[model samples]
Target: MSKKDSAKATLNDLNGKEWVKATKSWFVVNPKPRSAGQANHPAKYPEELVSRFLRFFTKADAWVLDPFAGVGSTLVAAKELGRNAIGVELNGEYVEIGSRHLEKTKGSGRTYLIMGNAHGTLEHLGEIFKDSIPPFSLLMTSPPYWNMLRKSRGGNDSVQKEREASGFDTYYSDSEEDIGNLDDYAEYIDTIGEIFDRLEPILAKNAYLVIVVQNMRDIDGEMKPIAWDLARRLSKTYALRQEMIWCQDNKRLGCWGYPTTYVSNVHHHHCLILQKR
Candidate 1:
């Protein structure tokens, strides 16, 4: 067979699989507990979760980027999958910790962890990438659930008590620049949207962007539809594609509003998938 025929055959083989398996609206994942290095971050998505998305959206040697790289989970997954990755993290502490994790990953793919605010660092992407920014094939990240961490106070609840005993601060950072510390919900969402807008120029055409977020109750017990609002805002730049619900069934049920009001123990997250238009 000719070389062209071989290439066509390979394409056919890739398309023959049931790619629709990923289209399922929801997934039940039992993520393993965080490793000691990742324990410092209040919120760290499982590397397995990032790996699954990376396999679906990208191929070997393709570029992957994470603007809000908490502990470099995305970068670690990318390297393991043989994809080069760049991560922008705000906290210096997290950058240091995540850098150590990256060094331990045994893979051929390259990884870069930039220690700076995502918003500021985005402007210098080309410089960071050595004079010209490469188009990223995939963007997968989870932002801070706006201000929820700050509101979490140690209580008699076993989970809260355990976290408090561990001496881990509930919030991501004390920095005023941290989006999780923002008190104004509208401003916080707008700020996040703006970051995506800035990223639009750097993203490759038709590339997929996945944002993992969850709705949460505010300090006043009001439900803040963060997931929905962000989707709507980001639709201005990228096409709003489907959403996959990430369900976690392992969490112990907590009686939030016992007999008083209807409050759900939210066990699912909105995995909003967007494509560059």
Candidate 2:
């Protein structure tokens, strides 16, 4: 067979791999407990979860990018799987903590964590990657849940209590530049959209962008469909391929509206899969 035919056959085999075939629309994941450094961040995606997605979406030595690199779980996973990774984070403290975690991991891949707001850091990233800036193979991140952390006070839940004891501010940062601190939902969405818009030029053709997000409830007890809204807006730029629901079965039941009303205990996140058009 010709060299091109041989390559096509290998790609066909990869697409038919067992894990790819088994990937369902919805699945349950019980992530292991976080390490002390990882636990410092209020909202952190587990390394195991990130690893699974990485395996499914990319091969060895592929470049991975995470714009909202909260504690760098994605970078850790990328390193372990032999993928070069670049992460951009707004908080300097988190960049420090994430760099420490990357140092402890055993791997042959390269990981770089940049401390800057993702909205304005594309040029910095281009400088860092220089000739290789336009072809990142995968982008995965979980942005702030839209001011949810800022409203965590006065709750009796163990998780809430633990967060209060962490000494870090309840939300991501006090900087007015942080998107999580924005009270206006529309503005928050627009800002996030703009960030992704700027990121578009950096993504390679057919590369995947996975965003882990959930809808939230406001202080006034109204439902905010953040995941759906993001999907609608970002679909303008990237193709909305599909959603893989990450269901959590380990969360304790909350008495959100015990006797007066009914409220859902949102124990799932939308793993939105978007492919560059």
Candidate 2, residues 51-90: lDDT per residue as tens digits? Answer: 8788777778888899999789899999998988989998
Query: RMSDs, each prediction?
Result: 2.8, 2.2
lDDT (CA) per prediction: 0.84, 0.84
| Alpha carbon deviation, residue 94, candidate 1 (Å) | 1.0
In the range 1-277, model 1's lDDT, one tens digit per residue, is 9998887434112343546676678988877987686887888888888887887888788889899998899999888989999999888889899999999988878899987777875665766766678889888999898888777632367465577779875678888889898999999999999889888878877889999999988767788999999999999999998998999899888776667877678889999999999
TM per model?
A: 0.92, 0.92
Q: After superposition, how far is residue 203 of candidate 2 from its true place, in Å?
A: 0.7
Error of 2 at 216 (Å): 0.6
Question: In candidate 2, residue 222 scores what lDDT?
Answer: 90
Question: Which residue pairs clash in candidate 1?
Answer: none
